[model samples]
Target: MSRWLLCLILVLGLTGCQSSAATNPKLPYAAWYLGFLAPNYMEVWLERADISDINGLIFPRAMGGVVAMGQPESLSATARGWPKRIGSGKGRSMTGLDLPYVVSLRWQSMVEPQTYHAAFLIPDWARRKMVESLPADCPVSGRTSDYRKDLTIGLAPGGVVKVWIMGPCLDPIEVLTLQAEIEPKGPYGGKSGGKYRPLSPVVKAYVDKYGVPYGSWWAPIPYTTVGP
Candidate 1:
């Protein structure tokens, strides 16, 4: 190989090394090291909210994989973390989540384990059957709106079908519903023919023992920090 060509390659290699350092530049000491080790290890605050218009939260995947939360504006500076979260594939089971018959995911992203708020989204219409299923403390109050959405799906189902909440994550009671009819045709796509599954184990046991705040999608949960 030519000496000049070899020299050029060495210079480029050194520059690339320097550029890599700036990728995660200026991060907090802990966030840097921990995030460097495992981005999923990062944990931040999910501020409290009052989701008058929202009704449920679902995590299709957790741990170090992709995570989708909130809506288009949910990630914006002023957006309430209560977004219509969409996950890439079915996730592992939590105490309350059921993993099958899920569909029409809007967006999907991975978690970085830094302090960040995970938003919740309310189904546009509440299911009369699910009305009793909502948290006991959940107030049955709000103007009704049409349940509406569009999307694609898989030909074969995998993982938990429905994910229920077990914490104070916010959602709208009015928007809650047992999703509509589904007709899976083939892999890589399908339409939302009004299909959804019933969520279980929504609120933590503490709330069941002692009542807590009523959150809504029409409203934002109050700004309170939850710790690492």
Candidate 2:
């Protein structure tokens, strides 16, 4: 090939490589919504998977944690303002998967303390979908076409927990479920302090429509998102 023709080919090859590198799959991102369903507030926290329990930091602290306010409302104004775009590539779980973070929940009962714990993992397939969801940034295109992601966690009475990945472009994915435990009534049931608060309206509506169901830890949740 002529000198100028060869240089042109090399330049084009470099451009293609750069494009591929820029688009390589990255850690997925999503907003995290957390809520508890008991009569009194619950304390919740997230920690790096490998962090020593003796030294790991917890989000929001105990007094300012993600409280058990009720079921998180996705369409409400509060939804948009929840913590967003948490980046994760942390420790590994026992199964050799990429363990991003561990979720810890604690609450009190009339006679004893209760707890629920779980971890979030990322799989190969989710990484691919995250890459595909990347949107173009043209001044005219705007962000309307962008794919939004949300990871919602709900903890009910008796340590029952449910997690789901929800977004406009994809159907909701139920990632984790923890079975309910039979326990003494907490403050909510007027068993302890004689103070009572009903479950949040959203949670109550769901219970009214469909009674609480039993479940168990079936699968590790895939971490699409968590708090900052």
Candidate 3:
């Protein structure tokens, strides 16, 4: 083959390898999205929260493994205002062959007692506690209400993982407290709610095991955006 042609082939081969590596980075855990959520949303929020840099640390929670020193490309895309398809906002669950993952949110208002809203998916023990601690018909709307905070935890073929949201806040201290409440706890200790079973298997297990429908463990980092 001509030298020029051979060089072109080599360059093309290297480019293909790089692209493949980007799509599958040999992550420590099997990462997938559940429900209507998408990684893109978290990417956007992370940038807005000023957590643009994770310091080259990638912790894969589900598989109980670490990814050494590598930053996520999604983080960069989010910083650059890349277009993404978040969801329809109509509320739907993800199904089929993809792995399972959870998303949690905690909204903390600047109000007194530092009212916090938390949500997550954990083993049965933690969920039961959350349910008992939080009011059944907890009001979700108010000027300083912790609404829109939710937890989605469940099993995917790989294992379990949690995603959490904490904030748009004026007080850093309050945000810290809200972040501390979502850590996982022991197994279920209370009665199960038959009426709530159909809501979400992952959530139900949490309630059945811990009396709380979600675990609490979230810490808010800063996020920022660069463009209009």
Candidate 4:
């Protein structure tokens, strides 16, 4: 059995092992990550069965590498430390804004740790709002996409944004699904405006108890910071 199958089996067994009364509420992003990783296993099995158009299978593993390593506590620690690393100039510049943003890191493959991609995504409306809200001294600037690597967006702080490190998958359905699940929700329970909130309590508890440990800083396409 392949590693993916083993993982699935393990998950299934754990689910079965628990009492029915022990059920826990699910996390939105956790489902998204599972969706992202499922296709890779499906593709692997299909390939072994001599199926065609197995390209879709590749993205799950690539994306799984990211989800596997994106532990919330670790990420929170990273966020807390970033202000210091960026130094007084950039750190103060970033902290002055009132918006919330996302940071994502993507690794090239499960094995290769030092290669990855990073990006920042801010909506145009958010940028305008930020400019209007903040003082003139802390104006935001956009970064151009080189295509080869690197993507940056500038905006006024305090709007919803998503930052992801994705593989070179021609089809991004899985990626889109995952994004939708994790994207912020508004105050009235819509899309997140601009902030990082913990996943639903059930989901948070699940991750705290069962999710894999995340500790990679050298992934290819690694380390993305998106915000106000």
Candidate 5:
């Protein structure tokens, strides 16, 4: 079957499969839940450093790769982590480590998959939001969790990528926005469907439920910031 046809099949068969498994409530740190919104089929790999102060947090690349597509958004699996304590006894404090986070993605065009890669740096605003002070009643040895647990990625034609991050204690914050070096490749020599490709079933469903927030078509979404 054609790639588009296979994607359509996944849309029909994988309906209601967007939700990821729930993270444990008692965990004291951020557990990442990844979500993706796109009009085309994509293979995604997430990479992060092994040494992090956020204990138990794992990268999706370690779990192989993620297959994502559709609209509204589809979530893959969850990565759990907790805050690691520093020192000992009354002097113990939470250690928040800053590590590199990277993403490699492949989108299947008409003839082949066009690959793109980008790295995410936790912005200052997000870093501040992650490290709120502990409450007075909390033990002196205990500390607040310092991590954003949710990440969403929006993909458009021509390699436009928009990324957002949030957590239970924070609101959604856009961290990365850029147009990648994606070679031109699509239906009709890339002329017929620059941003007018018909809505796939998954996208149509999202429109039916939430309406289109991007004016008309979703692709070529306006860029808020252009660089890293």
Candidate 6:
């Protein structure tokens, strides 16, 4: 063999060799996520697989959440104000294979405590506890009654991650990842937020029909343009 051919042979021998196993290419599994919705806020609140202690994050006794499934594409579509068939509305549930992967959705939106007219209905003890958690200058609490905030947390193999909710107001589409604590403590449950009461008749209908979990009754968006 020529000097060039001998050098080529040596180079090939030093490196492991591999080739395509089949003529047809196989597609990878698409990354579909459990699209957790933040009730009336109409946003992709977060995404995750079921981890223990997640209930507190989703169904905090003080607030509620709803669940759905989506692709990265779907979340992008939602930000543009044109959510596809999967986006949910008040009293509606969107079902798909991903339904089983969802942990849950929080029921309260930043506006819920205020919009539900829940201030007067809160038990005195719960109200007092909320007041004590804030600064003396920040006397009021409950939903975003006098303030607005968004929280973000993430999880990885060895640890959890977070993007502290900054700003008094956040975009509805802001995404966060957080640790799951088997359950949430008494944090959110605006009056009629459904922490203690039966699901609204309309919310129950969706649950019964789809067998999907939902938090509160005030979905402000429709699942489809034609309506669900």
Candidate models: Cα lDDT each:
0.22, 0.34, 0.22, 0.22, 0.36, 0.24
User: Stretches of candidate 4 above 4 Å error?
Assistant: 1-91, 94-115, 134-209, 213-228
Residue 61 error, candidate 5, Å = 2.3
Flag the better candidate by TM-score, 1 or 2: 2
Residues 68-123 of candidate 6: C-alpha lDDT, one tens digit per residue: 32224222222222232223211211111111111222322221111111100112
| Predicted structure 5, TM vs. truth | 0.38
After the best TM-score superposition of candidate 6, give how far the Cα of residue 215 lies from its true spot, in angstroms: 14
- 10 residues in a row with least lDDT, candidate 2: 46-55
Deviation from native of the Cα of residue 202 in model 5, angstroms: 6.4
- The per-prediction CA RMSD against the true structure, in angstroms, equals 22.0, 17.6, 22.7, 21.4, 15.8, 23.8
lDDT of 4 by residue, 1-228 (tens): 235644543444343322322323232111111111111101100001000011111111112221211224333432111112110010111111122222232322221111222222224433233223222221233322111111111110111112221212111111111111121232212433432333445335533454423232112122333223
TM-score for each candidate, following the candidate numbering: 0.17, 0.35, 0.19, 0.17, 0.38, 0.21
Model 3 per-residue lDDT tens digits across residues 5-60: 34533443344322212343232223322222222112101100000001111111
Quote the positional error of residue 190 for candidate 6 in Å: 18
Q: What's the CA RMSD of model 4 in angstroms?
A: 21.4
- Candidate 4 worst ten-residue window by lDDT: 43-52
Q: In order, how many clashes per candidate?
A: 46, 3, 42, 18, 0, 22
Off by over 4 Å in 2: 1-57, 60-100, 107-148, 156-158, 180-195, 198-228
For candidate 2, the clash count comes to 3
**Residue 189 of model 3, lDDT score:** 12
